[model samples]
Target: MIELSRVPDQEMWSISFGGDCANVAIYCARLGLETHFMSATGQDPYSASMRAFLTAEGVCDDLLLVHHDRLPGLYAIQTDASGERTFTYWRDSSAARGFHEVEGSAQALQNASEADVFYLSGITLSLFDRNYRAQIAELARSVRARGGHVAFDGNYRARGWADPAAAREAVASMAGHCSIALPTFDDERALHGDTHEDQAIRRWHDAGVDLVVLKVGAEGAVVSSKDGTAERVPIAQPRDAYDTTGAGDSFNAGFLSAYLAGATALEAAAAGNRLAGEVVMHPGAIIPAEAMPV
Candidate 1:
């Protein structure tokens, strides 16, 4: 979707390619991962731009499927005085929502089982109907069975679901097959009304997720595992954030980058916090390549 924000002298807009999983893939590639992104998009100017952007960012788009007759979705961001942004979307019939129906989707998903890790988010699930949700679950199961790690982020949006119960059910089912569960405390509270972080962690662990990384805003992130070990990774330093848009998403990229590179979960959480701290200081979900920590 397109992003618009305010500057000192006037309001301006910036458009870029952004979807949750795609966002992670971009950051991971920049962070030295051989990241491949798979998705469906229309054959439009924006879709063309997206493909080019993904390529220029060092992300592999070989699995991106093009729909002949549709348009990509668009969203607008409006920020408050506090820099917190609200969204307005026009994606009900976006070509990406029909990803399962895209010709190469099944093959691309099947091929994902061979990867070292597979990542997805609740927003990805919200694009599908009930049947496709089950298809995604089966794909996650396949990845796990083949000894590949499945990572999940419960990036929930109420507008994405038909009801709270279905959202909860679907998220739990996906969580059951994930080895790494990255969830935001605010989303968990909104979904299950859990009052504490530990409660949310237990729920994720109970669903068969072995490693849990729960992000709690500026408090940093909490890392836990099924082995009954847990630790809090506080922010390394205070940040003057301009936009909080992709903080959690980039956190996932940084944490996964560290974890897959053999860092302990606590270390990964700290890495995530460090990257997120940097991301929030920028105006969008992504920062310039030079802005990344050394």
Candidate 2:
């Protein structure tokens, strides 16, 4: 959501290294976690710049994929005078689509299996081929099998999936494999056509996830655990939003940052609200490092 696209009258232009996983990985690195980003980039100057930017953000480069023939994806944030944004993207033939290249596949998969917690999104899944998707899913299952957490976000972009049903099926299958599921209520409603937030939560719970965070935009969010416990935590304050692109992504980052540090679901959701609230006040998916709270 924080990437680049050409639009009239949005005159303010800036470049930031962004993606759902990148935003979360940046947040994790800033939060003092050992973070690794698994994705491919082009051999172009833009990709070189992206590598430098991510390094400066504290993300380890060891698993970051590099490809000679492709280019990084791009997106545009079309904002009204009021700062509300709608996006148009150009990622269809990007290098990210070939993410499971063997150069680092085994190592990256091993890292996923060994991480205390592994995070990914629907866009992340869309990058892989069908076989690669299965491979990634198996790595997530391996992480959980070893008593680690596997967190998933159903950040479905209609433009990314071949069809709504395919997105639903892929996301649903991935949900069944996750230990913690974080999904935006609107995305869930659109994808699964589940009328109520509870039904969406139930779908994941029934699939065996131990915890779920249902992000309901302005109404706040619901945090549910396997024991049938559900807690509604309100947003800390309302806002005249600057950008909503990565609100949910950063929310997951903050929530997982606290959770991995031993916070309760409610406490983590509160952390999520606090972070997302701040992110929407900024102009992009990623805010300045100095602006972050320690």
Error of 1 at 144 (Å): 0.7
lDDT (0-100) at residue 208 of candidate 2? 87
TM-score of 1: 0.97
Across 51-109, the per-residue lDDT of candidate 2 in tens digits comes to 88888989998878887777888887766666566888888777777666537767877
Give the distance in Å from residue 190's predicted Cα in candidate 1 to where it truly belongs: 0.4
Q: lDDT of all the models against the reference? A: 0.86, 0.83
Which ten residues in a row are the worst by lDDT in model 1?
Answer: 1-10
Estimate the TM-score for candidate 2.
Answer: 0.94
- TM-score for each predicted model, relative to the true structure: 0.97, 0.94
Residue 16 displacement in candidate 1 (angstroms):
2.0
Q: Which stretches of candidate 2 lie above 4 Å from their native place?
A: 5-12, 81-83
